[model samples]
Target: MKFFARIVAVLGGALIFFVGLGTAVFKSGLLGLVICLAAGAFVWWVFAQEREEYRGNIEALNRETGLNFKEAFGSGTTSMCIDETARKLALLEQGGAKHRLFGFEEIDDWELRWTEVSRNGSLSFQNVHFTFRTTQLEMPIFKVGVNSKLNGETWSQKLRLLMA
Candidate 1:
């Protein structure tokens, strides 16, 4: 649903932009075209900045964990499996070639953080951070997302229960 909303937003923005361009071209000729072009360039630049920020976040996570994003989240090529009965959590990468596993006993601590983002004095969205510890690395394992607070808390509780 979130993905669909994003797609709709992008399409709507493009439609509005083209409509504005058409109106400008019909009115001011070459000058309008130049203005429309400038607007398009500005929009492109904004999207580029957003993409860079997302990429930087992934790079930072990779650097801290010494694992590629694909290896960590599987990126649709793998699956994350948790076995509470066995007290194990595993990240199964594509082709089953490289996998990571951690026993519950190895965890030192864990935390779930919820961050709220607002715009124009109104609530916008929420970000959830799930961080856990393991003796294999100096830094903790972290997973962050823009998911519902209820779902985040539920997952956090389940994981904590398993760890306990």
Candidate 2:
């Protein structure tokens, strides 16, 4: 949906640019040139604003998704965060539940935990594994993946899920 919106926006801007240019070149007034420049400026401003908004919008999405980041993976219940546990015990007990497997953070915000395995024939440089241990005893293990690139590719399981 966002992709489609972005395409439509680009096309609309292009149409405006070309129409402005056409009027400037073919019409017989200084106002036409002014209008063309104004149109170009408008498009530039819109794009610049959109560029900044893109980050905030993405962050909003991340937070929205992250609300269930822990629940999504079943690392902990919203309640009972455990009043006090040893640091090592807490880390061991919480497991990977603190991570959201489907949020934008899961897709974009991550530090790589490199493994010794890499497939020479595959573009995938790593297998992102998330293990969530929930207080619920058994919650469906939630996991998606981030690719090694910024283009937003994901792991094999995610590819299959997308296909399904």
Candidate 3:
């Protein structure tokens, strides 16, 4: 499924780039090249793990959302919390399962702007920034596995499945 998603994203980016480039075949070819380059750059940035950002963070993160701090880290056993900007996330263990599950395998950015809550539901998941920030969204990487690499160092890498 994620492979299909990546294909779709690449195709969409290519379509825009080629459409812009097709215009250049008539002598605006430089602009078309630029369009394709920009699209490629954006795609790479979206999927690559900017791991340096994880430097020196807590094992048990103190997350903040539209919900306040104390409210954010409320009584949950094993749960996830996204940040206020919604660009990053952290999982919290409120004292329950001590399994080896690390974190979300998905690595792409998901943005939504159309989620509506009843405003009276139980306090569980942290509050989102907007009403729609949690609505209809998907990402490029859906499952990841930690592995020992050729260098003998363990790393978390995106899982790749081959469909016949």
Candidate 4:
């Protein structure tokens, strides 16, 4: 899915660039070319930033837990499941039975951090980070969109209640 999105972005950017170039040559002047260049630059910047973030995330995970996060959470499509009966949270990735389980008893603390970016009085982006305790590593469970903030807060509350 992410790969497909990247492909779409590249193709869309290229299309915009070509259209702008054609317009500049046939009808419009330098204005068309400038708009096209801006569109292409934006696409390239977005992809570059995303790549840097992935690299940083993997490096941090490796430094803290010695786990290769890129291999563990391939394509970042991890399915999260909470078992109330067992008091555990499980992460399933890559259609494999292999998973990482976090018992409520093992958690010492948890926090959900949220950030929002606004541009011209309009919300541009909102993100949430879930950080919690592990036996040996204090790693964040996930960083997701603002829509997941409520769920993350609920999960953290449940874990705290279980601990108490």
Top-scoring candidate (lDDT): 4
Better of 2 and 3 by TM-score: 2
Residue 121 Cα positional deviation in candidate 3, in Å, after optimal superposition: 63
| CA lDDT, candidate 2, residue 36 | 65
**Local distance difference test, each candidate:** 0.56, 0.39, 0.36, 0.58
- Angstrom error at residue 164, model 4: 4.3
- RMSD of every candidate to native, in Å, equals 10.9, 13.3, 18.4, 10.4
Sorted by lDDT, highest first, which candidate order results?
A: 4, 1, 2, 3
Q: Which stretches of model 3 miss by more than 4 angstroms?
A: 1-7, 49-164
Candidate 1 ranges with C-alpha deviation above 4 Å = 1-80, 92-98, 138-140, 144-146
lDDT (tens digit, per residue) of candidate 1 on 14-115: 765776688776876666667567667666765665446445644554455554443122222233446555666655433233456667777777666666
Q: How far off is residue 39 in model 3, in Å?
A: 1.1
Candidate 4: lDDT of 36?
Answer: 95
On the 0 to 100 scale, the lDDT of residue 72 in model 1 is: 24
| TM-score per candidate, chains pooled | 0.44, 0.33, 0.28, 0.43
Sorted by TM-score, highest first, which candidate order results? Answer: 1, 4, 2, 3
Candidate 2 deviant stretches above 4 angstroms: 57-164
Error of 4 at 72 (Å): 20
Clashes of 4: 0
